[model samples]
Target: MIYREYGQTGKKLSVVGFGGMRFGPDEDYGAQVVQRANSLGINYFDTAPFYCNDRSEDIFGKAFKNMPGQYYVSTKSNVGKESTADQVRWRIENSLKRMGIDKINFFHMWCIMDLNQYDRVMAKGGPYEGALKAKEEGLIDHLVFSTHCKGSDIRKIIEDDVFEGVLLGYNVVNHAFRQEGVQAALENKLGIVTMNPLGGGLIPQHQDYFSLLKEREDETVSQAALRFNAAQEGITVVLAGMGTIEEVEENVKIVDHPLTVSKEKVQEIRSKITESMDMLCTACGYCNKCPQKINIPTYMEAYNLSILKDDQETKHRLNWLREQEKIKEDDAKTDACVACGICEELCTQKLPIIERLKEMSLKY
Candidate 1:
């Protein structure tokens, strides 16, 4: 695997870091996947307490036992607003125990979504203090954070200059909106680890739309996505959650080479991606204040899957979204849009909200 300098830490991390979130029901298969990844020279493994129903750490501990100090292990804590310093410390100790490691190479403050979350972390006796204490105690080497905030807010957070690195979602599709965050992380000399580089499997399922990014005949859409992120100016690692050995092998092949799409090529493919969609939503959250409180962007994404792709997995996302919502038997959802066209009035894209919700109503 190709390696890059992890910011100012002076450590080399594999470009294709193995995300330990998708390990399977079978323990042996999980180990085999990790073993295959290690064989392929993927030296960075990232996991979190919330992944795979909290079993990732336990599996990683066993899978990584025989090869101590051979890999850079990273994990996160989801502790937040309500957590005390004692709970924060317990989270670190528990993660160490679960990973069966004396020291965590990278221990993150977990998913800090906004400036409010940042304030909470910096509060007296908060998780940030706990993480710092752990670092001083030799339990962790670096402090990091992951965020789902938009690029502009992310830039604001990175300007604090507190973290050694950051984990954020920056995929081929949303890079235009997220590039600012990546720029800020780079400006601060913080290592950037990109998650969802494939837009959560969107590129692979809709390969025809991403054909402009395929640099070589042998390059898969997945490879193009990984290379796209790794080729960026400041990206230290492109994290992929591989569930199978085949996935490990395929990703390793892509990371073995440093071929990346140029800025011209990226713009070319991005235009294609934008043009191929019937009614795209950039998910800017403009429609979030709906009278029904509907998650319009998510539904739009599901609608994009239904309209743009031919795969069963992508089509099934509608059902996944349905089951993910929490509502009373008669509560409002996509079907409750009421065709007021209010969201369209505010949408920068001017997406036909009522029409798309009608499509979803008919389909789902």
Candidate 2:
């Protein structure tokens, strides 16, 4: 496995870190996947409280018991969920207990959506203060943040000089969206870990559309997408959510091969990212806060089919979601959107969410 210094942290982390959010229902299988990644030299394992129905940390604890080598654990606390120092401290202890670890290698102020939320996290007795107290008590080794904020907003957060690292949603499709933040992290010598390197399965699911990312005939679109993120200038880790042993092994193979992709090829791919591609939703769920209680991400994900194919496909996708009960009866439909524009404001990709909702309203 290829390792890089996580900024100035003095610890060399595997370039392909294991994201623990995608584990299946079988916790034993999840534990096996974690152990396999560790055995293959994946030393950085990241989880959060509610990932995998709140079983993610417990799975990591299960795997850590018999881990063959050393590894680092990263977990998080949401400011909206646990806003105070005491609450955060209790969360830290709970995470430590769940993971069976003494000290958290990296603890994040989780999911800052904007500068306003960032300020809330950094308020005198808020989540950041709680993390700081945990760090002082040696419960957390490094204080980092995970965000869905824009690149400029990220630059502002980094300038505060409080976080030792950052976890942001970055991928081949939306690299330009977060480039400024990546550059700022590099400039400040802070650890940079990128999530959604596969666009949350968008790239892989539509491999024909993303075929431009592949440099070699043998490389799958998934590998090409992963390589694109790993080859970027400031990315310290290309975090992939590996659910099975096969996924773990495939991700690790990228590290075994050359990590470099020609800059011209990268630019070629970048230049081809159309307006529709830019609007494609990765289903990150930042827009789930709709006051109308609409399932924005689900609709946007269905909308992705319209971008890739046609409105008929989008309708079919929505039908499937409805049949599967992903869109519940109480959830507001697209027509219910009040043009309040909250989803667009919270969107990390800065997508034209209201416009798209109107389009969906008309079509369906």
Candidate 3:
């Protein structure tokens, strides 16, 4: 795989790193996946304490138990001083135990969103302080953070200049170039690695990213996305979710022969993706479990991308969601919603789903 320097650390990492979240099957699959990735020159692997309810860490730990120190491992903490101090250490130690590792090459504070949340962590003896304590004790080698927000929020964090790197879900499909966070990461020379390089693995739907390519059937969507996201400047690593052994190999092949998406293609993809993702739901499975037996977002997603347009990509995403228990079989459809607004109250996006679902269900 191709390598790039991670910020000012002078540490070179593969352009395509293995993401630990999608490793599947068997009890020890995590270790199996990591070892395979390591064998393929994937020096970087990212896992979090909350991934797979922490089982992901356990699996990752088992995978690299006897491996050399060449590969770099990174984990994240979700203890945000929003919890008790005990919860803070519990989260960190639990990751350590699960990974069976002494130190994380990079310890991200996880994904911080708004300025209010940012301010809370910056306060005296706050979560940031706790992370620093871990770093001082050699538990974490570098301090980093991740985000799904826009530029202003990201700028707020970099203003402190306390972090060594930043991780965000960037892709050719949703370049989010207009976002201040992307600009700041580039301007500040922070370790700006990208996640969801395949646009959160909407592998079958790459054609939709570019309006010009919407009707193109020859190109593989995955290849287009990987090239597009990896070609940009300032991206240290482009994280790929290589669940299967073959997928990992494909990514390695691409990194060896690096290429990029053009600016016109980038703009085309951005516009198409923006037009496609009506609810801004990348099917991340964040808005889950409508108590009234409603599938809410997924149903709308299905109506638009699957039932309405090409079902290939939507089906791929929904299949993964189904495996995660996020998709309840035969759950309430848009037509089933009675405007009770119960699902809306539970929705983090506060999406007017009960109404939109009806309209979408009818249209798509």
Candidate 4:
């Protein structure tokens, strides 16, 4: 139930914020999870309509009926170039209705990946105007943005000075790449909420890579991730998408007395990880915008596990990789890569993707 100052906003938020993307099908179970989170002093809950095929908001609707104003609700607007201000306001109003809340504490422009998208949103008659209008009308308290852009582009987004805060991907493997953005947010006094603190499950998948984070005998890989992110200098909160009550309790325990790891220790861990594995995919999803839609991150994770962990774990990940849906434009497979080299260019870590794909193709 520990809290931290959310930048300079005068708001104290739970160090472990609830991400509403993974709520299960059981209504009562979801409600109890929310209730338990509330009892543990988790006040910040974030969701978007696209998450869980839009059922996540409905779960919140049921969970927040009598507990109004006891928590801070955060949601996003998914709009495009043709979207008007009314449409943006409608998105906000719809989220409010679904969550049974009067107003949202933070409303974000969701999934903005680059300056092109940012310009489109801020352009005339775009969703940005609609969000501003909603804020003026008291529907939303603050304006924010969520991005999956490269680390270099992240500071550019912050420099626009439009958003009060930002949500971006930051985890153990990608900390060095993301540190620039974190520093910029700190400079701007923006509230920094990091998503994928576990590298979108990559940390759990490669437990041996993050051994230095395990300070206590009872600590799990995920707990180490939560502590690592929570201890970062400018981070406001670390959001972990928990589907079950067990996940919630585990996260609560870690954040209740979150451990702080030193920079030297972190660098030593990174060095060891570098020595242990030939491929390093932080699962940032930057290279996921492939024309062929090859699911590079997932396969790369499986590949790393295959080399680092036991064969059974590797087989499990490979099976998981096989089950993932591919883009309809082409038959997606490891061997399907045309070697256009677009992914390599976009890759932050400069992974030898084509070579890896060639290697992985034999397994299929």
Please provide TM-scores, in order, for all candidate models, with all chains considered together.
Answer: 0.83, 0.94, 0.78, 0.87
> What lDDT tens digits, residue by residue, belong to model 4 across residues 324-352?
64223355778889999988866755679
- Please, what are the lDDT tens digits per residue for candidate 3 over residues 25-122? 66465566677778877798988765665567777878877664478888876545334334555667777877788888888877675566666656
- The global C-alpha lDDT for each of the candidates, from Candidate 1 onward, is 0.78, 0.90, 0.67, 0.80
Residues 1-364 of candidate 1: C-alpha lDDT, one tens digit per residue? 6788887888899889999989889877787788778878889999988788878888888787765336898988765533666778888899899878899998877877667877888789888888888889999998988877667778887887888899987777767667788999999899999988876666787778777678888888889888888888899999999999999989989855655777788678666654454544555565666887777777776667655664354458766755765333455666788777767755534568888887667766
> Model 3: how far is 113 from its true place, Å?
2.9
Model 2 superposed RMSD (Cα) = 2.0
CA shift at 109, candidate 2, in angstroms?
0.6
Model 4 misplaced regions, further than 4 Å:
80-82, 274-279, 282-289, 293-298, 306-336, 341-352, 358-364
Q: Count the backbone clashes (under 3 Å) in each candidate.
A: 0, 0, 4, 0
Q: Best candidate per TM-score, number? A: 2
User: lDDT of model 4 at residue 26?
Assistant: 90
lDDT of 4 at 276: 47
Greater-TM-score candidate between 2 and 3: 2
Among the numbered candidates, top lDDT falls to 2
